[model samples]
Every structure is written in C-alpha cells, then in structure tokens.
Target: MKTTTAFPQASRSRSGWLIAISLLLLLAMALISLGVGPVSIPLETVWQWVLQRESQESLSEFTILSSLRLPRVVASLWIGAALATAGVGFQCLFRNPLADPYVIGASSGAALGVATSVVVGGTWSVAGFNPTSMFAMMGAIATVGLVFVIGSSRRGTSSLTLLLAGVAVSSLANALVSLLMFVHDGQKTMVILNWLLGSLASSNWQTLPAVLVLSTAGMFWLWMMARQLDAYSLGDIASQSLGLDLFRLRLSVVLAASLATAAAVSTAGVIGFVGLIAPQIARLLVGTRHTLLIPMSALLGASITLIADAAARTVVAPAELPVGILTAMLGCPFFLGLLLRRPRTYSRPGRRGG
Candidate 1:
C-alpha cells in the first residue's frame, strides 16, 4: 500500500513541476506575441509596457499595445483555457477520445443564436457587448439540454448515443443558420459569414471580464471536483460502488463545460480543436489524473491559441485571417494524422485505457 501510494504522490509532484514550467513557457510565448506584428516592437518594449511604465515608443505603438493588442491576447488566453478545460470534462464525461465541446454541437447551437440575432434586424449591444453573446449562451445551453434529452434515458446519457445526437443536432443548426444567411442581404451575409469563421479582432477591455469570470468559474468547479471526474473514468458500476453520484456529477460537469464553451464562443467565435488537441497533449505529457490534466491542458491550450492567433493576425499582413481558420488548418491535419496512426487504439478502447 505504501509503495503504491508513493508512486502516485511522486508522479503528482512531478506533474506539478511540469505545470509550473509550462506556465513559464506560456508567459514567454505571450510576451513574444506582444512584440510580434507589423510594427515589430522589441521584447524589452513589450516588457516595459507590461510593467505599466512609460516607453519611448511612438504614440501609435502605445495605443496599439494598450488599446488594441492586450485585450485580444488576454481574451485568447482565457478562451483557450476555457475551451481546453471543457474538452477535459467532456472527454472524461463521455469517456470518448473524440468528445469535445464543439464535437457535441454546443458551438453550432451558439452559432445559430448569434446568426438569429444578426439576421433579425441586426445585433444589439449593451455596454460594449453585443446581444449575440447572450443569444449564443442561451443557444448553447438549450442545445446541450436538448442533447441530453435525446441521448439520455432512465439509465442516463449514453456516450455513443450522445455523439450521434450531437451530429444530428449540429446538422439541423447549420441548416437554420444557412436559411438565415440566405434571407439577409449581401452586407449582413458577409458579417454573419465573418463571424462564423471566428476571430478575436472584436475583443476589448469592457467585455473581457464577463468571459473571464464565466470561464474561470467553470474551471474552478471542474478543479474542485477533479477526483470525482477521475473516478468517473472507471465503469459506472465501479464509480457508484465507490460512492460517486453518477447522475449529479454528470449533470454538473456537462453544465460547467457547456457554460464555458458558450462563453468562449461568444467572445472568440467558435474556435475548434483547442479543446481536443490541448487535452490530448497534456494527457500524453502528464498521464490521466484530472487534477494534473486540467491545468496542463489549459497551459498548452493557451499556448496553441496564442500561436494560432498570432499567425492569423500576421500571416495575411494588413488583412487578417480569422483565428478559427488558423486553428482548423493546424488541428485538422493533426487530427487526421492521429486517426491514421491509431485506428485500432481508437476503435478498441477501454475508457481510452484511462
């Protein structure tokens, strides 16, 4: 017993250090991102701006850093973390390797809500935030609830059934979105289309707090229930025998992940595959325990989002590409490669050998 306990304790300690190192790496990447772009400020200048100290840089540079760049970066960090954390929860909940917030159609639902707001006499903003964000949240929650209703029965949500339900619902949402786009004129059509592509260009200081708070709350809840999520990887019978309330635990996690994904979509416009790739990478590095997986995944997620957004903004020079496009470009190929590499592993699985 002592020997068995010692290994996990030692592994946990190692995982903690890995998280710390990853955090430092993430900070370095963020700082590098701040310095990158058309203006090409020095890293020292970026650091100086970060310290709230005056820099000798031009006023335009100052404005870009303070007003334009910082908020978008912060938003990316939060959104990445939120998406990744949701991926962890959904993966654990469904016990399916392919499960993700977007995979389950939560994002599609959110997109439909935003589309409705935009198409029906334009979107409204309160303070600085648009009505589309609120609509997206409601849409995501509704979609997730509908999925559970369709996929679950007296026994509870079946993982395979839930996946199928998500696909069916997603197709329906896309059809509705297409119908709305067709009804609108060219201008509104372009706007809706741009939104669907996903970008962080609209992020600002005023609305960042709401997304941050929602995502943080979700992460906190997942972190608080880490052990329960881990226990869930075991068969339901085993989990129940160990005194885990399968129903309540499943409900709470699904809600938390949906809320987080909604907040992210509202801010960032449906960036996909961060949730999937980040967790898989973290699990590869640190193994299966949720406590370690959650934070580690968040770090990698933020890093990946940061890099993708940097490319999105700079790759096209003055004309920016949507961050979502960049993520999809990177992730789609990686996903394909993963599938080709491990067809058998994915097909014959025991909780992904959790």
Candidate 2:
C-alpha cells in the first residue's frame, strides 16, 4: 500500500493556511465596517479620522466619524466578544453544543428589568433616579441564580435540568414583559421596543468605560479557566481524574459567563446570538481546545457584530435597523444546519470518542 503521510501533512498545512486567511478576512471586514454608513466616506478618510488627523472635511463629517461611528464600532467589538465568551463558557459547562448565553434566561431577565425600569420608573419615579441599567443587571443576576437553584439536585446539577429551568424562567419573564407592555403608556412603548430590539446608536465615551472594564475582566477570567474547561469537555469523571474540582469549576464558569452577559445586556440592551454563533464558528475552526477556542471566538464575534452593525446602519439609511435583528437573520440558518448535522454525544477520558 502507498504511504499516506503526505496527505496528512498537506491537510495540516491547508488547515493552517485556512486559519491565517480567516484572521485576514476578519480584519478586512472590520475595516470595511468603518467605511460604510449613510454618509459614505472613503477608507483612507476613515483611517485618518480614526487616527485623529484633521481632514479638509465638513464639521458634520468629522463629528459623525469621531463621535458616532467610533463609539458604535467599539461597542460592537466588546459586546460581541462578551457574548461569544459567555456562549463558549455555557456550552462547555452544559456539555451541550446548543447551549448559549441566553440558555439560562439572562436575556429575558435583562429584558424584564429594562422594561420595568422604563415603564415603572420612567413614569412613576421622581426626577433623579434612572434605574434602567441597575434593574437590568439585577434581573440578569436574579434569573441566573434562580436557574442554578432549580437545576441543582441532591446529587449534583444536571445540564438538562439547568436548560429546562432556564426555559421556564425565560418564559415567565417574557410573559411579565408582555403584561407590562400591555399596561404601559403609549409614549414609553417605543422606548421599550427599541430597548428590546437592541442598538449601538446610544454608545458614547461616557458609557464605554463600563463595557470596557466588564468585558475585559470577564474575558480575562474566562481565559484563565480555559484549561479547566477543556478538562470538563471530557466529562465529570474525566475532569475529576484530571485533578479538577467539578463543582467549583462549574460554579466559576457559570458566574463568569453570567457577569459578562449581564454587563453587555445592561449596557446595550439584549443583543443576541453573537454569543451563540461566534463560539460555534470557533469550534468548527479550532476543535474543542479552549485556549485557542476562546480567543478565536472573541475575534470572530467582534468581526460578526462589526459587520452586522455596519449593515444595520447602511441598509435602512437614516432610520437604522437594530443589531439584534441582523444577527438573528444571519444566525438562524447556520444554527439549524449545526443541529441537522448530528446529535453530539459527551464522553469521558479513556472511553472511545463518540
């Protein structure tokens, strides 16, 4: 028989080239995003504007580039990174490829919180207490706590239980949000709708610091746990054999994921699927190794959101569509394809790969 070593070597070489090309594509997309908008600007002008060089341009163009576009781009980058990190964390914790950040009801909780803040506080509270972000964070934390409690059994926590509880809590939260909408004053309904649909339009230097801090802290924390995450992918027995404390590992992953997600939702108001889709894309590219997987997901996530945000701005011109809508429009088909490919099975170390 002819030796096949050359084929394997060529395959590895091809995969390396593919990864390098994907990184280049991500960079190109990000640059393209900065260039396209309602008032189109050349890539060179956009680059100069980004570098703070004075262009012989109208004041409006300068303001649009610096004040509006820059903030949106930054927000999209961090938000996408946060969501993707959370998605990878959750999927690993549950050992379910289908698990996402919203699988634990964080989005619905944040939505309920935002709705309450806008409807109740905006209408009833006296001047000086805008609690929208506060309520949003509280709601997300509470929902995650509730899901964890419901999911844990006398023996331990089950991923299936966690998922089911999350669905229940999310459904209940959604119902409450609908009830609030029904009773909400006509004037505030638009505000509520916009909040749920999500946007980067409101981002500014004032709001940027919190997102930067939270996302940075969360991403760093997740990166630290990447090894433990890889161990867990081999299942509980495998993790224990590898010297990991299963409960502690799971707890840390869940908390880090929840905190990152809550921060993003509180800041930007429920942008979806950046988490779900980004990690999946990363897995397809890099396999299940968390060290490479986490960073790759962050890059992919940032790229996807940047492109989607650019489309949202240009597609509707002055009106502007929400970023969440664009992500859903793109993610749903890919998600379904993943589901149809195979039913994934979990396995422990020393067992045959399922």
Top candidate (TM-score): 1
Model 1 TM-score, 2 decimals: 0.91
Candidate 2 similarity to native, TM-score: 0.86
How much is the lDDT of residue 122 in candidate 1?
51
Tell me the TM-score of each prediction against the true structure: 0.91, 0.86
Off by over 4 Å in 1: 1-9, 55-57, 153-155, 336-354
Model 2, 1-354: lDDT tens digits are 122464555544454565577778877777667768888878887777767788465556778877877787888888888889999999998887768888899999988998888876653322221377668778999999988888775477766787888999999999999889888887677777888887877777766777678777888799899888988888788789999987778778878998888878877787888898889888877767787788778888888888888988999897899888998898888778875773343333354455
Clashes of each: 0, 0
Error of 2 at 228 (Å): 0.6
56 Cα displacement, candidate 2 (Å): 3.9
lDDT by residue (1-354, candidate 1, tens digit) is 012453547776788899999999998898889877656778877877777678464556778888888898898998999899999999998888778878778888988988888776554677566787777777888898898778776477667787788899999998999998898899878877887888998899988888999899988888788889888898799999999988789778888888889889987888978998889878878888887899998898899899999888889888899998899899889877876775264466456443
Most lDDT-accurate candidate? 1
